[model samples]
Target: MDHLADSQRVLTIGEGDGRFVAELVRRFPHIEVDCLEGSSAMIARARARLPSAAKVNFYHVDALNWEYPVEIYDAVVTCFFLDCFSDKTLREWLPRSINCSKPAGKWMVAEFREGVGGMERLRSRFWLRVMYLFFNWTTGLEAKQLPNWQGLLDELGYGCFEKSETSNAMIYSSVWQRWENARKTDGFNP
Candidate 1:
């Protein structure tokens, strides 16, 4: 939550077991999240495990169809989730992700990172591709290069405020803030 600019509304779009968002709320008691997840089991577990679940209301629904409540959140988070969509679905999800975020609000993403050459990296990438194809076909996710997340944020017109790659390069933690509610229709300035 320290990554957040200040005390404001926050929502976790693809909140899983609600673990990460839960942590966000824990540290910043003022932070609130309207967590949405498609999985019921995960949602139940998250509800049970979260210390701040009372503060963090949750909604169980598909991210693509769920209503975004019209510019209410100061931050939108899609951690380890967006990569599950196909380009078409990604396009849909992105706008909604943006919609949920208030003007000048932040968008944060935490994703698995395929590190540089090594047996570990090679194996991880191979499995990730296979998993993406399987899930993409099953769930209709894009499943391609969701890495280089900074690029993804830029391509969507969200400027990167700060980012960090895991020591093993196994994950990327990113925060991007939109300049305004309306995106440029093209992408980033650069």
Candidate 2:
């Protein structure tokens, strides 16, 4: 959360069970957070997890259809959330989602990724397939494979400045900032 220490407003999409939100508020009590979650059950769990005094607004809505406020947030966070959608959905949804943040905003993402090489790649592929199959069967998730999220973010004019991988490179966390030129050319107005 060091990256968000100075942020006044933050948005988190599909933040399950409020663990991250609770920790976020605990670390930065001054920040106001808006959490968009599709599941009411998850939202209830999240609300129960947080102290009543927390500066959190829980929106029980799907990110794809939610009308995002214009340039209102300092950062956007998605943890294991974007992987639930198909590539086509992401291409259309991500730009709109990121638009809610200011021109100099940060986007923090933690999600599953295919491994780099060798046995790591093979192991990642195996686990990913299993995960997709399980989630598809249980949750009716539309994504059968992980998309090139990094490439898509690049196209959206964001550049990754910090990144790390764990779980044998099957999972990654990264921080991204909008390119200076993108601020002027991306066409979103504050």
Candidate 3:
């Protein structure tokens, strides 16, 4: 949220139960937010959580397929959301996510990361596998493992301005800022 202190328009994908959105609306009264979530119940809960005067729009739509707003948002947030996608799906959707933001916009992500080594790596892998199985069975999620989101973000010309890890490197949060040169060289207007 600190990375987005100056943001005016924000987009949040998979804004689950609305805990984050509720606080975000309260803290940043001047900012407008568009929140996307697939579950109807979650959307209702999110709506109910927000204050009456909050400047927020809720969309009960799948993030992967929803039409992007096109280079308008000052910041894009996807907390614990991107891990649900396979590499193929991410390859298709990530660019759309980027294009939804302005040329020099901020992108914030928080999700599970594959651990580096030893016991930590084992623990991470085990839990991820369990999560994959459970989500696949329950929600029909496509990804069997965590996607290399950092790699894709780097390839798309985003620089990690801030990052932190916890749970023995099994979880990470990062703030990415898009580079001007990257957008120009890549011809990624809009």
Candidate 4:
């Protein structure tokens, strides 16, 4: 969360149970945060984790239908959240979500990814498939595979400037910033 220390305002989409938000507020007490979560039970659990004095606002609403404020946040975060949806959903949702941030705002994402090559790739793909199957069977999740997040981010005019990955490259966390001259597309206005 060091990358987010300088942010004055942040938005977290699908911030499940608020573990990351709690840590973020602990480390950067000065940053104000807004959490958008769809589940009431998850929101209640998350609310219970933070002290009453924490600077957080919880919005219990479906993320896909929520009205995002324009140019309001300094950073937008998604941790293990975006992977729950299909690429078609992400293409329609991500732009609207990112548009809530300022023109130069940062987008931080933490999620599972397929490895680059060799046994790592094989192992990652195996685990990802298992995860998809399990989640689909248990929760009726629609996504069957990992989306091309890198390509989607590129198309949306964001560039990854910082990243870290596990040894197997099955999981990754990345920080991205929109290009200075990037055009706002997909019906989202700057």
Candidate 5:
């Protein structure tokens, strides 16, 4: 977080309960973070679990209609928050979020990328579909495949020059550095 220069203004789209978000604020005491979450319950909880650091701000906002500051962030991160939307909503958000992202900025997303073993696959699929039916309808998310995000970024002109994965490939995350001209010459050392 300290490495990010423009992260002085950081935003989390679905920042529920400030605990996890507070971790970032705690680490980067000088950096300011603004979190947007739709659930009042979650937001209240977040306000309570405040990080030790005082450089944090909170807002009750939805993922789709939330406003972005005129200045972009140096880094944006999503953890287990992207899979809840439908394909249409995902499509809309990808572009909007990419726009919110800064040039040469880092965007990281962590999500469940693969179905589980045999029977578990079927069960997970059923639950995944159910989640889409229930949550996406309310949240206005367009159902989408997890890996398709790479293509979405490419379509929006991000090359995803670096990436990483964990949990036996079932969970993955990638950091995309955006550009307006030539693609940025960036890659993760890891």
Candidate 6:
């Protein structure tokens, strides 16, 4: 969130209960936000969390069906959200997500990652399996394993500018930026 302190327009996908959104609004009162979530209940909860004066547009729509337009946002965020979809779904959604950002826009992501090896890998896998089972039953999430979002981000012209990990690499939060020298289109000036 600190990386985006200067952003004037942000888009958050699956903003969940809106805790981050609320905090972002408080931290950067000048920014406008487009908050997208699939569940109306979650949307309502998120909206309630925001300050009454914050400028946020909440959209209750599936990310897959969102009409992503080019050069629309200064930053895009997804926290514990992309992991819900299968790799194929991510392949389809990621490009759309990046397409919404202006050239060199920031993309922030927070999600669990499969551990590298040893006991940590075993423990991480166990917890992830449990999560998959629970969310599959309770929320109908489709993915059984984490997708290679980093690779896709690279393929789509994003470069990791900052990254942090926890739980022995079982989880990670990263901020990637679309290349500053990326071709400009339709008056995009990043």
Model 1 lDDT per residue over 25-70, tens place: 7777777667889999989988887773357888989877886787
lDDT of 5 by residue, 1-190 (tens): 3334447767676776666677776666677777778889988888777755566676777767766754467677777677666556668877765667567667766676655478656766676667656766786755544436666766777666555666455566676665442253544332
**lDDT per residue, candidate 4, 9-49, as tens digits?**
99999999989999999889899999999999999999998
- Tell me how many residue pairs clash in candidate 3: 0
**Model 4 TM-score relative to the real fold:** 0.92
Give all candidates' CA lDDT scores.
0.71, 0.88, 0.85, 0.87, 0.65, 0.85
Stretches of model 3 off by over 4 angstroms after superposition? 180-190
Which residue pairs show collisions in model 5? 18-46, 86-141, 86-142, 86-143, 87-142, 87-143, 88-142, 89-142
Sort by lDDT, best first. Answer: 2, 4, 3, 6, 1, 5
Write one digit per residue (lDDT tens) for candidate 6, span 42-138.
9888988888899999988888888887898899999998898887988988886677888868788999988888988898999999999999999
Q: Which 10 consecutive residues of model 1 have the lowest summed lDDT?
A: 181-190
In terms of lDDT, which candidate is stronger, 3 or 4?
A: 4
Q: What TM-score would you give candidate 5 relative to the actual structure?
A: 0.74
Task: Please give, for residues 17-119, the per-residue lDDT of candidate 2 as tens digits.
Answer: 9999999999899999999999999999999988778999999997899999999899999999889988999989887777898988889999998878899
Minimal lDDT window, size 10, model 6: 181-190
TM-scores vs. true structure, each candidate: 0.77, 0.93, 0.90, 0.92, 0.74, 0.90
Cα RMSD of all models vs. native, in order, equals 4.9, 4.5, 4.5, 4.9, 4.2, 4.6
lDDT of 4: 0.87
